[model samples]
Target: MAILTNARMPVETVNFHLWQPCNMKCRFCFATFRDVRGTVLPEGHLPRRDAERVVTLLADAGFTKITFAGGEPLLCPWIIDLIRLAKGLGLTTALVTNGSLIDSGTIRDLRGILDWVTVSVDSVRSGTLALIGRMTAARAADERHYLDLCDRLKDAGLRLKINTVVTAANHLEDLTGFIVAARPERWKIFEVLPVQGQNSGKVEPLLVTPGQFARFVARSRSVEAYGIRVVPEDNDAMIGSYAMVDPAGRFFDAIGNGYTYSEPILRVGVRQAVSQVTVSRRKFLARGGLY
Candidate 1:
């Protein structure tokens, strides 16, 4: 079954980086490339009016889904408004969050606006989370909290998704138990990508070889029986398949060994901005990026 449905359009979905500030500092974050010098980080998200304009522009352009992502999307004060705007325009809306800021009040606030929520949970072991720089302390307690949040989200009648970044640190750790416990509708496993300006030099120690990644995929197959779909994305499979907009509202994509970006959609217009990036429709559909 399709995870979420959307109207047929030229660009089926777009992943917008709502902001760059995050509560946790994961060692393998690709968004670090946005600020290579680590000096000019965005102080806040796109202004509320501007964000609404962007959503209207995307919806007008026939984009069927808009996924609000970030260093931590929940940090954006206008996140719920954006989701509500996108849904109001007849678009399927999703949010990619670290799951740290999720609480009863937040979930209640998001009730009817969001169609999907993807939480980043790299490892079930607290030690692994600390090693990966995802948790500062009380790793075990944090894990329990994340699991409980997933349950609450499910109980609230929201479709749930889990995002696990596979790096050398946690690649070998069996995740079957975590998968079973969470019982998410979709579990996306991504191979750690090395961007030229971000984590390229510092992430070598945390990189996983293709053989190691394949083994992890093989082991993760056990969750299929539980009706949890596993979506795997190695580096090669990710390039050109995603429609990404940085925090500045510029569309960017991986090209060769570096990155390519377009003028901000607000300035050049969505069609012109999207024209600058290459999106593989076949790959997008194969990955179930479309509803």
Candidate 2:
């Protein structure tokens, strides 16, 4: 049975994957955008004015918050300009990055307008990160590097979020100690997901059983006492819960197995474009997408 929605959609948040190139190649990344990378947009992203237009369209569409993510958003040269413009438009801005490019300079650039910085830290161990392809170099201070990033963001008065995807490689590793030390405002623990068009075949080795994912969640409970909201998202909880956009500025949704994309919002306009895919505000809330 199909669920019908009202025409009046109150979009609270949207994740804008503005860039398609990344420095670090994680094995389980679902936002690779490899399919549309060179073919869809020649520059790997929308041109400057078009990029700003997309953000403007989103703000005018009344989205409360917009999360800037990418293959690695920091790699995009003009992303700060977009972030600053989004803030000026009255939309709460957030960034999801692998944390490699973030430095004192980047932090200084985002100090006032950027509300949250969510870093993807699956494991502090270099060997495991190598297996998962999260990071290439075996830096001696890997643990210290990430933990320090938490402190730096917090010190800048920007909210911190740590996203740990429990995979076969790090499912057994207890990240509670790290979580306690870093002390982020929110710790989002996601079971390694396999999206068809995104990471179907590539995600198989990284996938964990539900029980294994459960075990990881159980051990992570200790962080709640430290005022960290540990939110676990299994596959079911993640489906159809987010309003996500691709690098070419089109709305996309995760269907039964593969992804279904809308006509580019730039071409079709916001309402027609968003209507091409189904989004559940009810599901979004249940998944704790807000805050």
Candidate 3:
């Protein structure tokens, strides 16, 4: 469904997740990477014209940052072209990745096209790989490769942020290894939500409660003593200041709230969708949320 166009909403970030298909099968994916065969729906991908128009729309709507995400955004052959288009429009670009498909070639291509790259590094232990069902590479290997990719991107001088999805599986575990080892420009800690799975209706029960969250914040902040910047997204006012769009240009009311709008945003192109949606920022922000 598309968002209803109103004159009171603000459009902060527009995410263009081109595909639902991914290379890895992470158990925590709210998208349910295991049940689905990584299908990129017909409406999921943006053709050249659609992409160009989306950029134009974002520009017209006054959006400064456009994020390109995906099952693995690199899977979209036209991603670099889209980034260039966004940059040409004077918009800052970002990428959300699992850091598996990236290599030297991809890094070279993104040198200037993107302003930031957020990589998901949930855990760094090899033993945990089997737990996450990524035993093929071993958990340690996955973490190592992600760190290696981060190093490569940093060496290339691109800005990088390491995002960790906190869950029941790894909560009490020592994340200092990640703090000391990854040492990224930013370390984002996210509370695990059920949207990644069909049975996600049970997610709340699985989440770290408010008291637990407070403790998580404290421990995470202490990481700064070790030289890493930890940004926790828990009950923070600024969290409400930002908005996210899905792969289809649907502005997310919350992480997995599904497209908050009533129509498929891609129907009109990104620019129009953004313009139509952002004009109603106030109501959009107030549409029953807890940022």
lDDT of 1 by residue, 1-291 (tens): 012224333358999887777787788988754562243225646677877888898888778889998888888887887898899999999999888888889999889989999988898777788888886434433567778989999998889999998999999898888789989999999999888776676677899999988899889989999999999888888888888887777777886566677787889887778778877777787877766
**Candidate 2 per-residue lDDT over residues 127-201, each given as its tens digit:** 888888887454323788998889999999999999999999999998899999999989999988898767877
Q: Candidate 2: lDDT over CA atoms?
A: 0.86
Q: How far off is residue 24 in model 3, in Å?
A: 2.1
Model 3 misplacement above 4 A: 1-11, 31-40, 134-143, 196-206, 235-242, 254-259, 266-291
Write down the worst ten-residue block by lDDT for model 2. Answer: 1-10
Note the Cα lDDT for every prediction shown. 0.81, 0.86, 0.61
lDDT of 3 by residue, 1-291 (tens): 224345322655566655666666666555432222333345455566766675677666666777777667877887888888889898888888877678789999999888888887777776665565443444335566766787798888778787776666667666766666666777877766555343355445446666676676677786787777777655332233344445544544332343233134556644444443323345335432221
RMSD, every candidate, angstroms: 4.0, 2.0, 5.1
**Winning candidate number (TM-score):** 2
Q: How big is the positional error of residue 175 in model 3, measured in Å on the Cα after superposition? A: 2.1
Clashes of 1: 0
Structural similarity to truth (TM-score) of each candidate: 0.92, 0.95, 0.76
Candidate 2 runs further than 4 Å off: 1-10, 136-141
lDDT score, candidate 3, position 182: 65
* TM-score: model 3 vs. ground truth: 0.76
